[model samples]
Target: MDLDSQALNMSSRADLVEFLGGLADSFATHPERWQNANLPDFLNAWAAWLEDMDGYFQNRGESVPTSASWQLIAQMLLAARVYE
Candidate 1:
């Protein structure tokens, strides 16, 4: 899938939240693998980035991309081996 296009197409926060939840579940089920992959550090950085985005949106009274966007971004990063 063209993640850039897919990310632009996301229109709902709920959908994003669902997607993130699924990604989190995937990670949860394979703790050892994720840890070995250093996914925890990546996740922590991602979380911090999200917090910054959230704060930015809050300050501007603008909407942030839903968790779905984050999920898609995470997937794209994985696909690109950015985490590695």
Candidate 2:
């Protein structure tokens, strides 16, 4: 509702690309730090994390977004690393 609200932080298309590139760089630079080093396991973990993210928002007294946005997607991907 306000400028300070996280809702205002949506990334533009270019920003999203750059952000994802940064994630790629991070992963490339330090694959050893990741909990899921392979695709299948990471995908499974990512799906599980995204599924539970709504309840996490609810438990924190936040409203769960009915729709997904670029920011939410990025947050979920980041969380998937060790969310379980």
Candidate 3:
């Protein structure tokens, strides 16, 4: 299976996270099925962790961080890299 092709079909970050979570669950339930697993299965976990972090801040009356800022930062980093 082409992971990139499968990934391209995901319409949103939530979809991607759901797919990764299913994969992780499958591995956990049947380790033998993933004995040859090579690719890291951390993206979904990372997404969940970020969600928890956002929720923690929001529950404390802090504004939830928006991905817009991260997107802008990423764009600036990429622009700087190109100029370098």
- What local distance difference test score does each model get? 0.65, 0.72, 0.64
Q: Which parts of model 1 are misplaced by more than 4 Å?
A: 1-46, 82-84
- lDDT tens digits, residue span 1-84, model 3: 334565658677677667777777777778776545543455455557666887777788988756546676457557966784
lDDT: which candidate is best? 2
- Model 2: CA > 4 A from native: 1-8, 69-84
Q: Encode model 1's per-residue lDDT on 15-80: one tens digit a residue.
A: 555666665676677666454356678768768877788787778797875744557776766786
Name the lDDT value of residue 70 in candidate 2.
Answer: 54
Query: TM-scores for all candidates?
Result: 0.35, 0.62, 0.33
TM-score of 3: 0.33
Q: What CA root-mean-square deviation does each model show from the true structure? A: 11.8, 9.2, 14.7
Total backbone clashes of candidate 1, pairs 3 or more residues apart or in separate chains = 2
Q: Write the per-residue lDDT of candidate 2 for residues 1-84, one digit (tens) a residue.
A: 222332346457665556656667768998997899888988889889888988979998999877666587678678978887
Q: What is the lDDT of residue 24 in candidate 3?
A: 73
